[model samples]
Target: MKLLLTSGGVTNPTIRAALTDLLGKPIEECHALCVPTAQWGHPMCGPASVRGLLAAEPSFRHLTGLGWASLGALELTALPSIGRERWEPWVRGADVLLVDGGDATYLGHWLRKSGLADLFPSLPDTVWVGVSAGSMVMTPRIGDLFVEWAGAPDDRTLGVVEFSIFPHLDAFPTNTLEAAERWAADIGGPAYAIDEQTAIRVVDGHAEVVSEGRWFQLTR
Candidate 1:
């Protein structure tokens, strides 16, 4: 599996280029499916905000300019009427799975409940691009880093990757790099703290940090 986990979406040439490289094709030829389930997981955030966020999303504009075909949030898990067979093709056929950030616990629940977790390993050609909570959903768990960012920690994640990610480091109202580092210190396994300018790239089973911004990893 190929994963480009970012605090923010594709916001720079370095990260953009990394995504294009991972796609192994021109951006124009790619078909991307955006999943905004995480944002909806928040109690205060509504669908209007989610729509507004996606409508003017920098990453959406960035990719569209680069020639990508954006499928916008499918909302399959959100809508109960849609069966797996109906949306499974869309998930399986997409060139990229663009996961938007919001509440990690909320998103994690849907991923597991909706059976998306089982689909990750089968998506050999799909590049999973996670933004903030989207990135965190792939790990073993999301601990206390977010604090008041959202609901409680589900801890149980998709497990597509091993390390937990703390995104938006040093950003307002969220985690600062120092606090994140301290949180990582308590984590028993590998974890990372990254800002909007940073990303964690994972190919197969190996992971590496790619950044134009500041980042660090905590290891046992």
Candidate 2:
């Protein structure tokens, strides 16, 4: 699967261009699916947040409101109950998966439990557009500093990519570059600290940063 991992959604032209490149088509023509599963794992999110996303509220215009040809919801928590045979088609039919942010560990847990993680290997042409925790979930670890879910055993996630991510850099007072440096030291491996206007794009196995804002790569 191709990856367009962002701290925020497609909030800028550069990132949107990267997403379109990954999709190989216009956003209007693509059939998209929104995964709100990660939001449930966060204390600050709930029904209202999920509803706003699905309804394409102004706040989510960069994401689900991108005006796709069609849009659908895929709740990972419900997948195990229905069986993969019934849901596989739904995933296979979509052009891209818009994964919103919350807790990477929680999203990773369900991705495994729901068997979606196992399915990713076969979807070579599918595009995965991830935001914040959605982006972090693709990395090896999120670092303890970013952990917010009470149920998470640790900061580790799927490791779909070889690096870690410190998102929302400078957007939050606590997400300053100095804090990201400390987070990177804790990660002890390749990682990135990206601002809201930045993103990391991965096609095949190669990764590239596409940004209109500040970003740093840590190799400690």
Best by lDDT: 2
Q: Write the per-residue lDDT of candidate 1 for residues 1-220, one digit (tens) a residue.
A: 6999998778788998899899998777888777878877765567775775557555345332345666655663654467778788878788987787777777878887787777777887789888888888888877754533445554556677888887888776657777777777766678888888888889988898888988887664
Structure candidate 1, residue pairs in collision: 28-67
Off by over 4 Å in 1: 57-67, 147-153
lDDT of 2 by residue, 92-175 (tens): 999999999988999999999999999999999899999999999999999988788899999999999999899999998899
Clash counts per candidate, in order, are 1, 0
Runs of candidate 2 exceeding 4 Å displacement: none
Query: Cα lDDT of model 2 overall?
Result: 0.94
lDDT of 1: 0.76
